[model samples]
Target: MTLDLQQRANRRMRRAVITLGVLVLVLVAALVVIALRGGDAPPKGAPAPQPSTTAPKPTATLPPDDGGYVAPAETVKLPDGATKSGDLPVKFPRTPDGAAAMAVASARNAWSLDPQRIRAGILAYASAQYRDQMAASADAGAKGNREFAGIPATGPVPAGATLNAWPIGVKYAAVDSDTVDVLVLLRVTHAAKTGTQPTTTLIVSPGRAVWEGGDWKGTATDPNQPLPDPVDIGTVGFNEDRWQAIQEGDRL
Candidate 1:
């Protein structure tokens, strides 16, 4: 009877262990199902997550620069026999070639028959060194200056003579890091002449320009040099108002 009781006790212990294992497996399966379904949602009355309240940082912006020159203020007398006041100085092309064009155009404007305009051009356009040289040459009664071209010691231009200089082409050579040599082909005409058909002079002017005051200042180092005969590139009407504008130091 004691042996039979020991067998029955062992059987009861085994059944208890199996029942515990089955309960543990059922609990693990329930947990896995809940995990796969993504846990429970928040209570229905809870507020939604608040958006960030801090302001966004502003992006940086730079001031605008056209890379061109701005003309200073001046008072100029217009060609219409009216004295006009200039509100702002003219702006020229900011590039090297553009600067060369302005230099030549201003030089051409200096050839006006008006004495005052001639003086103004010298003051407005020429380099400080060139200006001093021109003054010294004039005081010495020199014929002409290499830097100032056909401007005479006595007068800048002849009486009743007006010369219009237009550049046909421009070629630039780097003389050094700071200097440039420009070969400009120009057609010069005297529209004020009494002749029915005005003769024009096609010339090649070699100018040496140095960077000064944020712009290229050109001087006619070799004004007498003539190029090979050039073909007629046609002509345009001479506008006095445009001449006046250039005289007033406008960048064209």
Candidate 2:
């Protein structure tokens, strides 16, 4: 009877161990199926968006320049052979009488000029804005300056040194840009010796210009001369020769 009881206890223990092993095997199989299903499924179309790589920016532009004063149409070779541009130059009318009268009028309008000072230098200097032209006229006075600031002397004009008269020699010439030329015979005066009155001589050159305000004017500078000053928009037509042309006493 004791031997039978021991055999029955051993059988019961073996059955419990087998049940535990089967439960553990079922749990492991279920976990493996779940993992295989997840791995085998097709991937979704939408993915997390990534950051973008940016490109470089473009360059900036500069502003346009408005010429207040009449300037050269483009760059020009200077007397020194160097080139420069962007400046306001005086414009001259292309007529003999206009050229002759310009200097006289400028002299007459020279503010507070010593009425008796004769305006020798003023008359010559104010003819046009060209340093070259003015220097050319130095011989019209008492000075021996062959040149002023490196400009050679150009002598003998169409008119006299003193343009104190009217209906002087006049001629017209044409240039680019509807520009007309005026060649005027100026009458310049020199101090007389031996109690003689101022002597006179003729000066003729083309007065450069456009037909504005009932007259043609000259470019303050020679054609293509480099400008030391910048073009001013506020004074587009306000040039030295233009100013001299329309002065109070200059209504020709």
Candidate 3:
């Protein structure tokens, strides 16, 4: 009976050892598969990896920083045969192309309050260079007084006076180029109880001028329309209202 029991025990031990060996082999195979999938498997003949979501982005190109957004206007070069005068080359629309350029020019001109007509008048007449003389004359003219106290026509207008009317009765007049006009109007433009300072002036005066060429030469400019020469500023011209206002109290 003892011999039989020992044999049975030995058989059982052998079976148990074999089962443990089989389980160990299975575990080793599973670990190998996991390692291969992690990084060691033969890349499956796949393409190289693309950038992932967490990868850094490429740098973007940006425009150069300048004081102004507009690229500096480039000077145009003219063709050899396009010379206008001396070494200067003339290159531009030989002919006006329909209304595009004209339309743009007109729009820009209209945006300005002053017109070329009034500008022409200033060039042909008022000497802005002589500010003091004009101011003194203006004072005398408005007060119906004269700076050359002896000469009733040459006096300074009193301090506190305004010229508040359109010197020229007509709103619009056709003036040819290169002419000067002296306008006379009655306006009260200051804070005086005397009828001299009307709430608003009702002035009717004359503009003396000659039409020469296509330019109206002598109009006047106020703080708004002032200029070295009116013709130089706007191609269209100065507005009559502002010019007249500048020479306010001085109108006869």
Candidate 4:
């Protein structure tokens, strides 16, 4: 390839990667907003609840020797004939594993190349309490299937280019019988030209799933805390035990 052509390819690759990063940031911002604005404000003139004076019981903690890693204990079980709401999958089980599965699926669809698809995915997966808030912002400036979040949309893969993503790892915590928190790490690969090597980007996204109306639905993920930074797959700090490998059927 000519020098000019190579430079263009490099620019395209950079733009694609940046677009993915921006999409993640936008999603996070939306989640934070919903968390802050969700639920009813305290009734006018209502008294605040009193705090308990008794000391709380100690909860279990990971052993220091374990390097703060917690092995995945839940098993994902998808029901037969799992259905789809629009283009996004729906109807996961009610267990912690099911919540984790739904969370991963939500992240995958939220990053879709089509803005319409993204909007539909948000509507389908978001918890009822926050779904409208999330959907209203899903494609604020998107138009004509060419732009979303100010980046060029992935309409069709060119002859010499490719783009794909898959869930590689996950960490989950069951908050209660009706809620679960999940952190998912996705591996996104893109190439601007057939001969050029593909660039790999890692994205770690957190999601909360609430059991509502007999199924799991996505919600803001711990807005009081900051989101985790993305990390490379094989970095020294990466803990295999903490991030359980997502099975093929569960991946997107």
Candidate 5:
């Protein structure tokens, strides 16, 4: 009877050892799977990984770090032509394409803020027909301003201030073998001393030129309409001297 009881106890001990060994094998297999998957098994009640909620910031269009003193657009020029009025070309291109380039450049300059440059730019580049019309318009405008201000006809009268314009883009299309239609996008800035703030205006205006009598002469930029849509370039202070330099073709 004693031997039988001892044997029964030994059998029970063996059964318990086998159960523990099987449990340990199952735990080792689970750990191996987690290791192969490149991450530890998460604890119970732990939250799952979540997707990111961040977004990239917008790119800055204007410079000086904080949107002031923005860089101007690149200036386009004729390889064999004078950039400004009365600038003698050392060697002229004599090609129709070259003439078109010069015509476009001159037409854009006609929108200068300075009165003298504006007049000169128009006269130098415009066709005789448009030139006369512009002259008449200028006369009418000056006369109307004088009458409104009650200034004498012969006395000096100040005209309205012109906006500073920088040509940002130019698109040219050949209308004919001798004529080219040019469209210029200008960044026009108006500086206000007593107003809320200064602003930049983006204008895409029309220009047409014909290769006439060995040179290109500009026609009315807008033969069909008066003006194009003006886009606001946001509120910012403009450096006038820099714009003047660009107009003078010194720095673009």
Candidate 6:
């Protein structure tokens, strides 16, 4: 009957959302590995370096230890009458914090099940030089989304279902006055219906952004640049890694 069909549709939508979230997490993991490894394979005959017993020293760019986590000193500022591109915010200040904010927003949008938001996010957040590449990636993502949902890329979710991703914590390293590398801890969630328990996944994604055209814009991650270690919130490593919790007002 109609009620049975509705339940089946909701279940299908939930499965699609969960599958899409897993795909995003896998993609993020691959990107992080590439960044960490500098995306280079060793020369065919080059001998591998022997492992060192000494512990690796922390990178010099990290904030000075204050016997505890050092909160980011810079604050994000929005432009006058700033608006959003789809559900993603646009027009952040020309500062390090602004770059971090933009990177975080980009990650949230890129991981969402809504393909329209993914496209809009790339257009609004990526740097001019990277837009075409990001657009191609978005297209691929949209195609995958459509395949999983059995609907058009811009189609709405089944009634009573919810799928979304958001940043929960952030860490950043300043590459210079004009560029920054940001790490965002994301929470991806899906619910089949109101009052139902939601399925959640966590991801730590790395991103880079530059100050350009009077606002912060996302750029490809620097293969050679060292990034901070990712840490989950509410863990000891979180404090040791100096991850800062995203404030309520900062959520995109």
Alpha-carbon lDDT of model 6: 0.48
User: How do the residues 84-160 of candidate 4 rate in per-residue lDDT, one tens digit apiece?
Assistant: 88656688888887877777776555544344665676666766665565456545412211121112333453456
Better of 1 and 3 by TM-score: 1
User: How close is every model to the real structure, measured as TM-score?
Assistant: 0.42, 0.25, 0.21, 0.58, 0.45, 0.58
lDDT tens readout by residue for model 1, 99-136: 45544554354333343444444444455555544333
The predicted structure with the larger lDDT, 5 or 6, is 6
List all candidate RMSDs to the true structure: 42.2, 46.3, 44.5, 14.7, 33.6, 14.5
Q: How many backbone clashes does candidate 3 have?
A: 32
| lDDT at position 131, candidate 4 | 57
What's the best-to-worst order under TM-score?
Answer: 6, 4, 5, 1, 2, 3
Candidate 5 clashing pairs, residues 3+ apart or interchain: none
Best by lDDT: 6
RMSD after Cα superposition, model 2: 46.3
lDDT of 3 by residue, 214-249 (tens): 211112212111112111011122232322222213
Error (Å) of candidate 2 at residue 43 is: 99
**lDDT scores for all predictions?**
0.33, 0.25, 0.21, 0.47, 0.36, 0.48
lDDT value, candidate 2, whole model: 0.25
lDDT agreement of model 1 with the native: 0.33
Q: Any residue pairs clashing in model 4, and if so which? A: none
Candidate 4 accuracy as TM-score: 0.58
Q: In candidate 2, where is summed lDDT lowest over 10 consecutive residues?
A: 50-59
Better candidate by lDDT, 1 or 4:
4
* Clashing pairs in model 1, backbone N/Cα/C closer than 3 A: 71-89
